[model samples]
Target chain A: MLSNKKTTNEKEIQKLIEELDNIISKKENILEINLDEKIRKLAELLSSSNSLEEINNCSEAIQRLAVIIFEKTKALKNRSGILYIDPFLMKLAILGSNIEKLSKAFIQSWRPVVGRDVINLFLLKDAMTYWNSITKYSFEAREEKTIENVSKISFLDERGINEEIEEMYNELERRGGKELYDKLIESKNLSEKIFKAVILSFMITYGYVGIIREPLKGKVWVVKKEKTIESKNPESFVIVVK
Target chain B: MEEESTKKLRRAAQLLFFKSHRNPGIKGWELRKALGQDYTKILKKLEEKINELGLTIKIVSDSGELRTLSDPHEVLSNCRFFISINDPLTITDLRTSGWSIDEIAGLTVCIATIISKEGKTTRQELEQILSQKLPKWKATRLLSKYIKAGYLDEKEDYIVLGWRTKSEVDLENIIRYIFS
Candidate 1:
């Protein structure tokens, strides 16, 4: 992964350096040309380019292409929701951004989606599906939480989880079925809340307790059920007075 | 069964098992790191040798990714319905709160894209597409949820299918569900 990063970084650096040189060398190259003319010229280059690789090879054109595409996409973003993208523009973004190609075709041939402001959103989907697999597994896979790792949970084992739930039940019993929306979470952290809620849910599903919340009042009545006999700690429980 | 082939099979299994557990799958270059550049051959050899270990390796045609397969029949049989009712209920809960569409759609998009491209794409790219297509906030919300739910995985720069879907549902059934 680190090595791939270096190679990619090198490529991106090379592309950026080339782009920077083009922008810096004013006398040798006409860097201060009109923006519209530049866009049209780049668009023509893209339209005429035989392959995506060939398009990519022209780093200056790809960089200039990104500016126009970025402007267009940004303008489109103001609308409520429409993920339209020109395939060539997307390819320009991909090439310009220096994303690794997943396709076997040495050059992805993108025909222009002409006469349309928004193209099929699927093109973006395709690009994402291809590039994310490479980026994720290669870069972020180790950090991603998985069942095997998240489920490792040594400090919060089954018995420990059950004990935590039992404590909640005890508090509910003392409060005589506490009011509705009792934040099941004792801690501020959302993970802690979710964990506690999950354990409490198990206790409820096992039939030891039941909660009835009023639809309008948003108040809950905790009722001790018949399965109280299974409790390791038996207490005088209050049934919700409906 | 701990011969040289078995050892390699186990190592490959340890490597690829959790990865193929979902809808979008892992690409070859990504796996090449741990398994080495010649991991493709190793995967093929393991594929030929791993029936006894209760796993199978498959190559995703579009993305050219390697994924592990578990018998759906055995998985269904082993699932204790009485204890695991939360599995479906959780989906229900997510649905009630509007997380399921993102989960289901994200899963569907990745599957469709994988089939469409015959190649893998980065999660950032998927998110980029989604950010364009859907409401920006909605897309952002869904991407994170999908990743968290294990319905979608973020690979090196790509997003592949995750393990949760691989174990829980049949691929064809899910595709059907998405369409219907």
Candidate 2:
């Protein structure tokens, strides 16, 4: 296990070095060209970040800047989301897009979706099956397999996620008014907050990073991502809560 | 007087044993059903003769399968000895003598086999293969111990037999002498 951990750490270090080189090359490209304001600002922010310590500390800030870059790019070219798209819908789209982008950006910018996201997910699932075998041998829990039991985990399609956001907006309209929506729109860190929340959900629940669980246990409850918010009874937050 | 009966019983018992390993926990009725030629009488005779050998059998409730925890290692060892005086010592017999020579032998065989195939081997590759296939911590811990004990030599990603001066150890020789 220690060897495995060491190997994984080595792999991560190698990947980090490669990614730093790629980002450096991009910075050099930006410097060479007469860059737009957005690219110029991004390049300035990326400068002087070569060491692992700086990279680890500034990565979240870099991602935040990337979100701003994305927004600014959209503003320059009046395409789908930034200018007129519903703010809630915009957040949903970015949430989906950022998960894909961050995963891609971390793995080497070349391989999209890691080319086998679902397969990798399934392999992680198989690791759990091995755990089950170990527990079975130990005579831990002799519970019968619940065959034909429909699970409560209903994964929403992209369309469904978008619709859910739209429905949230509709609920806000019914409960409060355009005033609350405008207030939410005014919050500068809204997108960043949403991204952070989404990432937290991914890390804690989705095994997107890797499921870390106790080695030996009879009954275990895995965390999962949820699309609900419990607090803030005001109009703007109603969409997410419902 | 009943030596012929005992021989028939042993033959039937071996058949039943093989069937159990193939399909564990078979019931008496199912065993009878399986024995098509004079099924009932032959099963009864077999059961009576087996009881005479002082081997008790029972049926498990949940699976309704025949279960027996009789001394299989002893039986196998005795059979091998009867077949030939040079049966050598079984791993269990070695284990009962208060040392785990079998485990060390097994590790030696593994190192030899890997070296033969990969030509050269390393500690990392050995750890990876052992951790992936065998019991993770135990195999790696043992491998490291073997390395420390001069049973294995590491070279990058290749592993080879350490101080043992065997120019060529075939797989059969590995299994028979090293692992046995």
Candidate 3:
């Protein structure tokens, strides 16, 4: 009867050792194994063993089992939550030979979030109201000093057109034809300056004045033409009046 | 008073639907300032109203975790509120939204690999895994796109799931489907 009991204990120890081996080899999921049950069975076996060799064998199995449990518990404690992944499934799906199949599997499961940007009248109105409330400064209308109407200098009128051109030419000649274009057009009133610029353009157009621009120096010299000669090729250039 | 409440509800809906910040959601305090102190009640009403339209409002905590309305008002106030479709999109819908199969597959691989690695992995490791199926350059570019789109985040050398993934993707269900 004692021999029969010894054999049973030996068989149970062998089965437990095989289970532990499967877990250690990662053939079975560590999380799925009943660790507490294994420990209890091992404790029962240790208590029932008749020989010193059997006790020693049971203690060794228990020590190995304790180490496995300790490692697993430490890993679990480190994890924030239970995000379990089946190692076999991961290998088969992600590291599998067929990547297209993995993609299809993802497509089958993906549920993308749906949200769109939208603008509505209600939103616009709220925005406007918010803007109006926060904007404390009123746009004060300072009376823009009305450009005082200077006596009409009509360069376009045929009656005074020649007189205007001649006056501009004589002025250019008086200034030694080397007056900077800006100095010639400079006036206290903006309108008067613009008027002078317009007349200067006409003077250039009629061949009474020629502008030599030193682009590097950014200076324009209104050289008086020695003789009035109609421009064979009159290229239009812009003269901005400040 | 009824008219005032209706106007507040409209204002709340408009605030949520029209994104004003760099991100797609509005903060709880902004809603309170717009809709009044009873913003939580207003949000609840707005949530019900949107639910009928097959839309839903999701609240994400400041730490990027999803929160429900059942959370305390103070907690909800600190959270971000955004709207999304209640139902998942079909594959055809995904294609229509300009997602290619390869890109989808690549994203799946990244998300799955990250989850397997306890929600974090090194960028070099992820790239190596991706390079098996895709060209090295393509994998690198795809990872950048994912990071930019808030699907994955890069912290120094480590890559973790992004806020958008936490708000949108159902990780558990995705894993189950992959195995299935």
Candidate 4:
């Protein structure tokens, strides 16, 4: 048991010596270090000659310095501060930094009232929430005639909705999806548009339908992403609030 | 001789990068004195370690306050995430002790309010600010906890960034998120 303990101590001492050697080797680049008091004390305890492997206490000190060094290096790496900002964010950050410096200077000079700022902050947040509740809209107004035009060209074969399934698909499929929206949704808003828009937005938002805006043609079209062989048939969405 | 040179380089790297109890980072002059020559060679080697990782040590000013390069959000975003916006350090300390969750929620808003406005505030200023909001003894104890952990540096009387918080954290990222 005593021999095994000695071996362990020897191994630890050897490890410490190797670590010190590694640090000591880079003399050209390394600046003079202000050694930690504990590290200095440990160095005093260690002999300059060989047979450091025989000393058990050396293991403890070496391990302590190791932990401290590791923590510092880890913190530095974690800073991630040593990075080049990607091009776009860099330009934006330059403007941001200038503004930040100016704002800091202004605040320091002005010595703004804390209480008023706090009150204003609460008021601003409240006002923003109120405005959002009043003004956020789901979809634009489009006439029901657009939907009728789409129904004429497109066929949904699943729910007994299309009378001429293959006929409609074959007819429209020839036009290469161009007439899908160009000839269909060109009409302006007519009556009962709100109800149709609400239903359409609900379907689009819930992934039951998708709208593609093609900038090339300056038109928007709806597409049904049909389920592939691997996909399970989707169930109807029921809104759940808990 | 080659091995000795390598060792010095490694030792210098450790001292330059590590946070000492007394200072945030090593100064450039001290580094120059150690190597008995220009510090650039050592800095170059250090740069080699981080270049591939998309990180470089930035020597802020001539003082050598080293910080890594990153987007504002990436810079100390973790610190911002960890610091609770509503609760004061007092509340956090009390809860750590035997104080109940219910007790923490209702403390005077003075500590957080004063610190936010002043940026770097002293213990006396905090006490005076919260003299009406909470007990003096309670505030002192809370501030002590933060100081001991190096979360807040109590330099003489003024509170500045602690060694642990030298990470350059800011709510600017929050502003960017909100406005963007």
Top model number, lDDT = 3
lDDT of 1 at A111: 11
Candidate 3 C-alpha lDDT tens digits along B3-26: 999999998887887766535777
Ranking by DockQ: 3, 1, 4, 2
lDDT of 3 at B81: 85
Once fitted onto the true fold, the runs of candidate 1 whose alpha carbons sit more than 4 angstroms away are A1-242, B1-103, B177-180
**TM-scores vs. true structure, each candidate:** 0.23, 0.19, 0.51, 0.26
lDDT of 2 at A220: 16
- Candidate 3 chain A least-lDDT 10 residues: A144-153
Best by TM-score: 3
What is the C-alpha lDDT profile of model 4 across B72-113, one tens digit per residue? Answer: 323322211111112112323433444343222111122222
lDDT of 2 by residue, B101-148 (tens): 534333543443453343345555555544543466666666655554
Q: Regarding lDDT, does 1 or 2 come out ahead?
A: 1
- lDDT at A152, model 2: 17
Interface RMSD of each: 22.3, 28.7, 14.5, 24.2
In terms of lDDT, which candidate is stronger, 3 or 4? 3
Candidate ordering by TM-score (highest first): 3, 4, 1, 2
Clashes of each: 55, 10, 0, 23
